[model samples]
Every structure is written in structure tokens, then in C-alpha cells.
Target: MDERFEIFLVATPGLEAPLAAEAAALGWQPVVGPGGVTITGGWADVWRANLWLRGATRVLVRVGSFRALHLAQLDKRARKFPWATVLRRDVPVRVETTCKASRIYHAGAATQRIERAIAEELGAPLAPDAALVVKVRIEDDLVTISLDTTGESLHKRGHKEAVAKAPMRETMAAMFLREMGFDGSQPVLDPMCGSGTFVIEAAEIAAGLAPGRSRSFGFQQLASFDAAAWETMRTAAAPRPAPAQFFGSDRDAGAIRMSLANAERAGVAGLTRFDCRAIGDLQRPDGPPGIVIVNPPYGARIGNKGPLFGLHAAMGAVFRERLQGWRMGIVTSEGGLAKATGLPLESGPVVAHGGLKVRLWQTGMV
Candidate 1:
């Protein structure tokens, strides 16, 4: 608390250990939680966490947290806190609040009070579409306010300008890879790499790349932001390459092209090879037994479940026939699609993502 650090990493449940591992790899002492990890440090830690944490959805910097008995005390303390340190007077910001076991349980009222205080007292503008968002959580009698230092979620790596239908976010993909026990040295294969997210994220990890290296962060605009310190951190945290071992394939030629473009923009094009081939054609390159992670199309909503069922059935057939000893991770929203694979899968954890409760069904062949 003395360091004024208020950052925590939110991830899929059962992934706290992997997220903690990624944080600790970057010299961050991360404490595991039920669904995430919390770390504390200085203002520079805030910037570095946003830039380097691959497994977190977003980094929330704790601005203020105090015990509040009533709405009056909440408003008073909120006003006294230095909002200017985190918010830019020129850029607009939105206040979002969630209330629980507290006297000020009305969320709208609390949000309005904080919004008015920041605007009238701190001279910050209010915009409905403000990229910078402040989240206030009231639990028990303590009110904790955190700034969403990552404007867009860290998944928006600014590389994949094109998005496929039901395209997975980069952050979610990274978290899934970590959940599958992916280490950087081993080869990674995405048989149905629709947009090449898994392979590209793996390549980035293998190359020691930071996820947010190509994008700008909200913390860069904060009043307390130090330009020289951030530059030094970026220079030091940039990724280095390993062996060429990332591979991805999709049946669609368009997806292959888009994936290639995304890889080029991400500067990991050399690390991954995107192929326009059916799953039957996927072959493991020369390496130790590695991962075969697939986010195959679920016949849930977009397509005909019957035909998509056939697709999942085909994927299962290919996996059973070809991948004898490789570990497999099959992600799907529909349990039936996952079951169709017919592989001996260990029940992985359930995670909320993209309007569906997706589960990662795995077969540990390695």
C-alpha cells in the first residue's frame, strides 16, 4: 500500500497459476487469486504490466480503496483522491461502478457522483465513448476504484486488422495456450487456425515477444507517466527469437491470407507458417512431441449444427488417425461438438468468453 500500486491481472478461472507464472517471469511477484493474480509495485510497474502481461485480459490499476460507511464519505474521499495523476484533463473518461454489500448500493447514483466530482472538481471531460474507463467496486464496506489502464483490452494487439466471424481475441488465445501448459521452446500447431491467433501468439511467446509491444497504452498518457522510464522499459522488454517451430493451417484460403498478413504485422511471420490445408493434411514438423490446439467451428449458432457436427466428427477422425502421440486441446462452446471428436479428453475448466461458456477439452498424449 505504501507503493501506491493498484494493479491486478484478471484471467479465466483455473488460470491464475499460469498468469502468475507470466507475471513472475517479468520479475513481478504475483499473488494468485480465485480467478486472477494481484501484484503491487510503483507507477512504472503499472506500465510494464500493461505492456508485458500476456495472460491477463486487462490491467486494473487501483486508484483508491477505503472503508466507506455512507455515500457522503465515499464522495468526499473520491474527491480528495488524485484523479489527475491517472486521468488526462484533455482526454475524456467514463466512470463505471459495481456495488455489493455496501450502504451506497445504487450503482447509477455512485457512478454519477464520481463522474460529477471528476468533471466539476478535476476539470476532466466526460464522453460516452471514452477509451479510458474507471471501474469502482464496492465490496463489504470497502470501496475500491481502479483505472482500466489498458484502453482496449490487451487482446487488441493492433496487428489483426481483419477479424473472422467468432474470431477469438489475442488475450483469450494466450490464456488458453498457457492453460494447455505451453512452454516457448516446444512446437505449436493449430490445425484449424482460423485467424492464426494460437500459432501467432505461440510464436510471440517462443520469441520472447511482449503482447502489447506494437500498441500504445492508456498509462502512457497519465499525468504521472514518465517518458524516459517507459522507453527504457520497452527497450528492455522487447522479445527475442527462438527456433522456427510455430505452424497453423485452415481450410479457407482467405483465412490463411489474413493470418499471414497478421503475422507480418506482428513481426513473427518468420516464426509461423500458415497453410491453406484441411485438417487431414496437417503434419508435424521435426521436433519433440508438442501441442495440437484447435478451436474448431462449433455448430452452435452461426452454421447448421448437423453439417458442423460432421465437421467436428471429421476433426475427431483426423486427430485419432494422425496425431498418435501429440497432445490436443479442443475448444468449443457446444459440448456435443467437443464430444464428437471422440478423443479421450480430460475435462478442462469452463471459462466465460465471447458470449459463451467455452470449455477446453484436452487429451494429454505427451
Candidate 2:
């Protein structure tokens, strides 16, 4: 029987269910956990998960597992597990370990133990910041080792050449759209759309564009990665034509320019209409009531919270006065700022984004 490897969909803890649903949509049976979801799949499935999962921060493939009672047994077994299958001997690797209720509770010392074992037994070189990293976890006498198939977080889709102040990540934007039940049909608007991340992600979704189509991943360096198969998959997953269904505006002309450039790079510029306008110009598009998602600046970046209070008040007034019955999703780190909207929204799940605890308060179901 072919070995079924464990695939982990790493996220910011609260989004595990949404990420799991995305994985399951791709035909992977995802078992949701606290911080991520685990599934059993082959090498090809692993590649698909990384390439297509818009909500996952990273996809880790479990390489091997065993019961190691002591440090010696871990070192001995680590040597025998054929690291060459996934890691090249010439390429350096960094060992990271996490222990919980296990014999090896000291993470730093345990990492050193595994590092020395690989260097001495397998002749693998160790670097301070290796392109490849092996993550080891010990829980209840069970040892599970996984390789970081995604060197950096998958959210770095490699397209945004520049970023504005307080920009949102592509993965988080896509997940937010999904959470708001975006089906890629209705017109979506992002007032205060800095660099157009939310609008661009929505355009990509509407056009069936693969998130990783224009990027490179660490899996390309692995020995087990089939180049021909990957090429075939890439060709098959090329971006399709997106209907003109995305709109966005920012008060800053610089942000609008950046959004246009990013949209051009993503090849969805024609599908999105970004303007150098403010929230006052926001009007209902030519369609059924659509979703409006915005990530406005809080006190952290822009200015004193005192001035921002009036801005939030105006935002609430505008939504109620003009955009009645339209779904509104506002991402804000400050609860007081969100409350300033006064849109009958007192509850929403908290999301950790960019080191800030954010909430996606939605009101007026479309």
C-alpha cells in the first residue's frame, strides 16, 4: 500500500474550520484541529493544497512518525528515515522542535539534539536560516516530524511588488471573502482599499485564478517533486477570464495606483475598477446588493483615536444612509472604533491579523 502522509493547513487558530472546508472542497478529507487541519494525501495532493488553498498560511507534509522514548532513540530513528527523499544533502536545513507532555520538554535543547543527529549521522549541513526546515513535535510519547514544504508563508504570492501602509495579506483577504459567503458573482467593493488586496482577491476568485499561479514554492526543490506533473498542473490551473465584477476606491491616489499595478500584475485589471475616490463616492453597483468589505485604518497607524472617531461615525452614517440592506464587512482592531459605526453589530469572531486582534463585524445581510 502507498504511504499516506499527513498534511497540515496552518492558520491563525480561529480559521481552522474555513481552511478545512477549503481543503475538503479540493477532495482532501480534512480533520479540523485547534490551530490547523490534518489530512492524508499523496505528493500531488500536497502540491495542490499549497497552490490552491487561499486560507492556509502554510501546508506542512508529515514525513515520518515514530515512538521515541528518549533522545538517543530520536537521534537514531531520525537518521534512518531517508531524509534524502525530501531534502537534498547539499541544501542546508534548520531543525525546530515543540514538546508537550513528553520526555523531551526542553525545545531548545531537543532541537540541538536533532540538529546534531542529522549532521553527524546523515551528513546534512545546518544553517542558521535554512531554505528547508524540519518541524518536530512530541506529544504523549509520539514523535511526528514534518517538513515545511512552503519555505515562506503561502500568503506571499510574489505578485505585490509594493505594499502600502497597513496592508492586508492575500490569504487573509481571501479567507475573509469566503467567510462572508462570497460566491464570486455579485459586485464587491472595498472602500479604503489600500493596495487593493481585498478587491484583487475577489477578482481572482471570480475569474477562477489560482492563487499560486505566478509564484514558486519550496516543494520544487524536493527530490520527490515531479517536475512534469507540476508543469501539467500549472498549465491546467491557469487563470481564467474574470467577468467585470470587482470595484474598489481609496481616498489616497497613491493607493489606487498601487492597486492598479497589482491588478495588472495579477492579470485581473480589466475585471476590477479601482478609483481614487473616498467612501462618500461609494454607491450601489449595477447588481443585486453585493458584499462590501473594507479594512480602514485604526489609531495604530493613521492618527489620534480622537480624530478617527469622527471618521468612524461618518462611515456608520454613510452605510446607514446610502447602503441600506447591503452586506457590510468591516475589519477593525479596536472595538471602540467598530462601535463608532453604530450598525447594530455587536458580535463577530475575532481574528489575529498582523499582530492585531481584528473582528469582521458584518451587518445588513444582502
lDDT of 2 by residue, 1-366 (tens): 145788888986567777887788788888998788999988888788888889999989998888888888877777677776777767788988999999877788778878887787667799988878899999986888898888788888878776888889888888888888897887788988989999999998888888888888878777787899998987796566657878888999999999999999988899999888788777766766788898988977666778888888898888788777778888888888888988776546778887678878777663
lDDT for residue 361 in candidate 2, whole number 0-100 = 77
Among all windows of 10 consecutive residues in model 1, the one with the lowest summed lDDT is: 1-10
Q: What is the C-alpha RMSD of each candidate to the true structure, in Å?
A: 2.3, 1.9
Question: In lDDT terms, how accurate is model 1?
Answer: 0.82
With candidate 2 superimposed using the best TM-score fit, by how many Å does residue 269's alpha carbon deviate from the native? 0.4
For model 1, residues 1-366, the per-residue Cα lDDT tens digits are 136675788876656777888899789788998778899887878887888888787888887788877788878888887887677788788989999988889989888888988997789999888888889898897889888888877778877786666887787788788878898977898988888899999999889887888889877767777788788888895567587888889889999998999999988998889889997787766777788888887765566778777788778788777767788898888888888778877766677776678888888883
- Looking at model 1, the pairs that clash are 6-62
